[model samples]
Target: MKITLEKVHGSMNTFYMVDGEERDDYANLALQLCAKDQGVDGLLVILPSNSAHAKMRVFNRDGSEASMCGNGLRCVARYVCEKEGVDEAVIETMKADLAVRREETLMDGIETYSVQISPVSFQLKDLPMEYDNQTTLIQQAIPEISEEIMFSAVAVPNPHLIGIVPEEIQKSPEHQKKWAEKFNGQNNYFSDGVNVSYVTKVGQGIFVRTYERGVGFTNACGTAMTASALISCMSDMVPFGEVAVYNPGGMVKCTVNKSGDTFELLLTGNATRLSVHEFQWEEEQVDSEFTAFEILDEQRQYEKFIEEISVVVEQFAKRKE
Candidate 1:
């Protein structure tokens, strides 16, 4: 069998997207393609959908399926848009049917996409967190991690535990990794585990580092950033507006709307189609290595886009200073 796949990234969180109609061994394929050596966060299998534009199925590097992925959605939207030549789409995930739009170009070569991450929830049952006597988990201290560190749990159909850390902690890469590791799955607080983000407020923006539940530390975790921004707004850490979210990979802008208990989030960022890999496989050979795959590089253009944005962000930071 011959398989063609697109490798794309949003805010540096990358995935290998393949059509579901082409193959049936997605779980094993995801594990193989998303290996650290392969340099991908996960694999997304795009399936046919009757309820929406298309169905998006996400698999972590560890081959665990996730309910939703904000970053992956942007890439999928871009894929569908470029493939179908449409400006808008509604992609179905396991959790919800998300609305996505191809926004104006952010850079000369990079296309920007905006995705609606909706149906936000803070209830314990939605996150399915093992907690008692609490309907909502908000800035609560889990003694298992520390006596001082407080966490806010929210699910944008994906479970996230966010901690507002000090500037110094967020600034130090070592500290960020340590804390991410501490609470990720090592801690006994969350039984099913959660994507953990350590966020720090910087000027009018915020910097985040996430230890994803199944993927561990990534360049960026879109839903984690959305969850971070939403919690920051709810906690009065950042006012409602265009929230610039800086992750280790790059930055993404999030527009948050909160009316009493209702919350809606819009995430806008680069949807970069880095390359395409074409390979030949046999159905019986699950772990077959593809030594003869073709690589089409779009990474150079993406790097240029990154460079343009980095300069802008630097100047903005300087102005703040």
Candidate 2:
């Protein structure tokens, strides 16, 4: 089947804008191809399945799907509202319902987007942090780190570990690597690997570098930003309300209620359309390549098929002068 998709890039993440209807049919293909091509940090699909409600699918470059992504949804919202000339769009993902609206203008002189994620859930099981809720979590001194690192567990859609790293560790690669390993260890207190943010106070806003699970160090993580803003509020670093979070990729401003429980994330940045491509498949070739009604593990076969197709695409791109 021939598919149409839009390639959009946000601060540090990339995504594919596709029709919501074709999500289940083509999401895996898009994920594998884009990841292999290094075309994006993730995939955001607007499924045509429910045109009334657009679906956003985020897939890591490694082909693993994520619950939610802030940067990606903002970019996709901008594309749909501004480019497509729509006012409000509802983006449904694996996590929760996201309401995104278009901005009049962006700092980069382009359209901007904002998404309303679910209220930050800190309940131990909800956040899925390894710790039990019986024990209260407060700012504590880390073993090696000199300054205090405020670590908190919050989940908008997926889980995240928002930590305030000392400026010393923020600048030291060795320190960053050390904690990254610590954060990744199963003993780190998270059933599923948690996205850890090493944040520093940089003037008016906090600067962040995040080590995300499944996706490794990314420029900006939307959920991480929301979590950080909430953590900052809880720690009294920033006032309760809208706060600015600066990352290497761009800036995301988030608003939290007085209780620091509900969070509204505004990812103010550019979403540039890089390229668009068509998908074409040779049915006869595919059929001939495999035996009719051959027995094979569906999951394993599909994985191998994706890998092989990616190699072909890469080879073709390299062949271009």
Pick by lDDT: which candidate is best?
1
How many clashes (backbone N, Cα, C below 3 Å) per candidate?
0, 9
Error at 117, model 2, angstroms:
2.0
**CA lDDT of each candidate?**
0.79, 0.61
* 1-321 per-residue lDDT for model 2 (tens digits): 565666665554656656545434344554455544553566677654254356677777656677888888887776566645687887777767778877654443444577776755666576566554333344654445435566666777677766687666666546565666675675656666678777677655676777777666776688787778777877888887777776655556777765333445444544556566554422332321111122222223222323433332232112111
lDDT computed for candidate 1: 0.79
Per-residue accuracy of model 1 over 1-321 as CA lDDT, tens digit each:
678888888978888888766455787778767542357889988999989989999999888889988888998998888788899999998988999999986666678899999778888778767665788889988665556667888888888888888865665557545655665555545656788888888778887788888887787888999999988887799998679887767788899997777888999988888777775545444545555445656657767766655643343222110
Residue 106 shift from truth in candidate 2, angstroms: 2.9
Off by over 4 Å in 1: 22-24, 173-188, 283-287, 291-297, 308-321
TM-score for every candidate vs. truth?
Answer: 0.89, 0.76
The CA lDDT at 252 in model 2 is 60
TM-score, cand. 1: 0.89
